[model samples]
Target: MPKKRRRISAFFKILTVLTVACGVLVAGGYYVIRSVQRVELTPPPPPSGCTLTAAGDTDELEVEQAANAATISGVAFGRDLPPHAVVVAFATVWQESKFRNIEFGDRDSVGLFQQRPSQEWGDPEQLMDPVYSSGEFYDGLVEIAGYEEMPVYEAAQAVQRSADGFAYDQHERRSRTMAAAFTGAEGPAVTCWYDTDEAGEADVEAAQAEMDRVFGTDGALPAAESRTGDPGWAMAAWAVANAERYGLTSVEYGGQRWSAAEGIDGWTEAPGEGGGAAAEDQVVLR
Candidate 1:
């Protein structure tokens, strides 16, 4: 009888140990998931029957594409964020750094959102990642007390805390128009560029070539001024918004080994370096 009781006690002890071990494992798994989140930036699907062709012009298509991409990404996580939200974010990006994830900053800012690595947004790579930066922006938006309920620009300002807070107002309208087109739930770089110089001119050519190969088109996208709601500006803004990620500066893309010869308007105005203001205005989606 004594031996049997001892055996039973040992079994209970073993069970308790196993239970504790499982609890630890489960907690560890949850922590890992929260830390390394897998965020997909895919845009929304087109409404029943819509295509890029319906945009009538590239400018319109650009707006549409931005709207689509932003809206899709906003909505994808089951968040139901408005298209205007994305517009606000895109416009802010344009003004912030011409949408280029620059290595430069106020004292030493870097990445698309001009985030400071010291702030804990992430290490260098996280700041440079559009998806992560954008995700952080979106997360802040959702956390606001009445962000979605307020005017989009106001809501965005609440999250961005920009030096030029009031300026974000104008961008709200433009973002919606562009978001509509890119709504197919795409994660395709709503922005991109092939830096010929920083990337060794050939790399630029190769990137451009890849775009042409898959997209089947020339280097020149229809200018947004004439395209009207096409995804051009949105796409350009994305490229500008995330330019630093590709290792480019305004002067670099302006000419040099790359090809800013046209004196563009989407990311940077015809003006010199600090053109974040004009660039912000250019990609307004609405």
Candidate 2:
């Protein structure tokens, strides 16, 4: 009887050990799963404005001003002006409106270039329109003799006649960087990120309409239905420049992608359907 009791006690001890071990394993597994869930549920970083650092690399902002600057340069490109012309246009606006479509400035100035209605730049309403203002800037720009050979600031001042002629030079380096990026001279160099939750969803129709308003009538843009291929890259760059204003979360071209959630990290190899060289002939904006 004593031996039998000892055997029974040993069995209970083994059972207890097994039960404790199993509970510990179950608890550990639960902790691991919960940890993974917590990580997965964490939200992406919020969106901010576009960026183009002074060093000509890495940058963030609302993309509206950026888009406007791009459009100004785009108009120059459409007119067959060299890249330097675009640089001059961008630098001019960087000094004038900081690329914004403002209604007021020093004196009676208005718009991105701050063209004064009194000075014959245009009516306030016309100057306020980016396309018209950009056209006006370019129109004045082309009239200067050998403006392309002159320094970017000098070229800008020749047209602007600002009180301070040297001011435009201060933005030359940065403007060149932006012009290169937006003009697609530097392949997917311009990248931006935004907070989708705050901005809501993107509107493709609005994007198409806006494109038509700016570059369409001049035959400078691809078909409104197309967003891929070489022409697609141009449209993609424009869309990226306008990302903040349009609630665009992502833009992909040439096997890379930029996400508003990615902030100033800039472009990266696209992931899955979102990144990588676009297999389709259309640019994807979401």
Candidate 3:
């Protein structure tokens, strides 16, 4: 009995030593690989609202900025759509208009989706509205194959018919990153905010009512945002900086062209989000 016990103890000691050695090798290898990789920390060029300041596209930046709440609702709650649907929608907008809906473009472009007036979409004034624009974009996208359920960029290109169709394919990882930054949902969902610029000073009655009709409850947005905004150019700049998220392009928003001028190392303070305390003032379109 003593000899048997001794043999078992010796075997156990050998196993422990091997396990420790293997663990060290794994840890060492992981550290070496990570140290050698020169990874890009950012999401690449057009560093969102922050980078737009460098391009003197402040007006455009505000247009692209997205509201966290509204975007979340759009992705998580919309019917016949899944959370990943939200990611795709987010990626599309992130790549398109950066979530900004506008009434002007380079030539004949207008609105958030940048549907060309008198060509691909409709008249100028109507196309300028975000809800109308997004709804239309959504309407067309649902028509694509597996779109309502497919990944975002794939569905987007099916609708956009863009030459750079693969572009949407690459935005998924980043889109999920942006969505996770706000509301953390399971795969296929994301969180977002509303565009204040497109409907600036415009009554949010319809939008709020739509929220109630669809969501069964308001998503608890700030009321002051719905009121007439006093924040100078921030409204405009927010739109431009975040345009790509929505899929805005030179030809999409009315042939509106984007160029790099110069950037202010520090952004001149513009009226930021949430200054009002009213309960009935905040709303998000689309």
How well is each residue in 116-180 modelled by candidate 2, as lDDT tens digits? 99999889999999889888888898899999899999999999998999999999877777776
TM-score of 1: 0.42
TM-score (C-alpha, index-matched) for candidate 3: 0.42
Off by over 4 Å in 3: 1-64, 68-78, 148-151, 180-286
- Model 1: residues with Cα > 4 Å off, grouped in runs: 1-80, 185-286
TM-score quality measure for candidate 2: 0.72
Residue 52 in model 3: lDDT: 21
For every model shown, what is its TM-score relative to the native structure?
Answer: 0.42, 0.72, 0.42
lDDT of 1 by residue, 130-230 (tens): 55676667677778886657876677678777777777777654455445444322222133233224333223444344323222236544333321233
Which of the two, 2 or 3, has more TM-score?
2
Candidate 2 local distance difference test against the native: 0.73
Give the Å shift of residue 266 in candidate 3. 24
After TM-score superposition, the amount by which residue 91's alpha carbon in candidate 3 deviates from its true location, in angstroms, is: 1.7
Q: Rate the local accuracy (lDDT) of all candidates.
A: 0.47, 0.73, 0.44
lDDT of 3 at 15: 97
